[model samples]
Target: MVKLIALYRHPEDQESFDKHYEQVHTPLVEKMPGLKKLEVTRIQGAPMGGEAKYYLEAAMYFADRAALDAAMSSPEGKASAKDLMGFAGSLVTMMIGEVSREG
Candidate 1:
């Protein structure tokens, strides 16, 4: 499996960010083709208990890198990309990786 991951930095307005994410961004992402699964996490604090650097983490699962690329090239993906740039472009870090689900 392959995964597209996004690490979101703390935004200036947390509430507004959350609202747009849940209401608009999520739906746009869900429309992506070849999406196997989507996992979103709200980061609370570090192991030492101060605070985590990132505010949220989103992982989008795909069958492989090809599927991921195809999905990202689709219309839905284009819309999501534009919306992302409008909102969290500067505050987000994104990566693609191969997944190993073995123990």
Candidate 2:
């Protein structure tokens, strides 16, 4: 499987960010054609009792890189990408990678 991981740093307004993320952004992401699963993480803290650099993490799963590419090339994907610019652009970091499993 391939996944698109998005790491979100703390935005200036936490409440607004959370509201928009849950209400608007998630729905847009769900519209992607090849999206298999979506996982979200609320970061707690870093090791050694320091602050965590990121506030939230989202993993969007696809069957493979080709599926992911197709999804991103679709109109829904474009809408999601454009929506990111509406909020929290500077605080987001995204990456795509293959999933590795260990038994």
Candidate 3:
């Protein structure tokens, strides 16, 4: 599997960011053609007892890199990308990678 991971820095307004993310951004992301699964996490303090650098993290899974690329090039993907610029651009860092799981 391949995944697109998004790390969100602390925003100026957490409430507003949460609202928009839940209400608008998530729906847009769900529209991607090859999206297999979506996972989100709210970061708390670091294990060492300091504040976390990231406020949130999201992972979007796909079958492979090709599927991921296709999804990102689709219309829904374009819309999601454009929407990110409106609110989360400066606060976000994104990456794509293969996933490994072991039981």
Clashes of each: 0, 0, 0
Prediction 1 global C-alpha lDDT: 0.96
lDDT (tens digit, per residue) of candidate 3 on 1-103:
9999999999999999999999999999999999999999999989999999999999999999999999999999999999998999999999998888823
* TM-score of each candidate structure, all chains considered together: 0.97, 0.95, 0.96
Regions of model 3 farther than 4 Å from truth: none
Model 1 scores a TM of 0.97
Model 3's TM-score against the true structure: 0.96
Q: Write the per-residue lDDT of candidate 1 for residues 24-87, one digit (tens) a residue.
A: 9999999999999999999999999998999999999999999999999999999999999999
lDDT of 2 by residue, 24-102 (tens): 9999999999899999999999988888999999999999999999999999999999998779789999999899982
- Per-residue lDDT value at 19 in model 1: 98
Order the candidates by TM-score, highest first — what do you get? 1, 3, 2
**In candidate 1, residue 53 scores what lDDT?**
99
lDDT of all predictions, in order shown? 0.96, 0.95, 0.96
Worst 10 residues of 3 by lDDT: 94-103
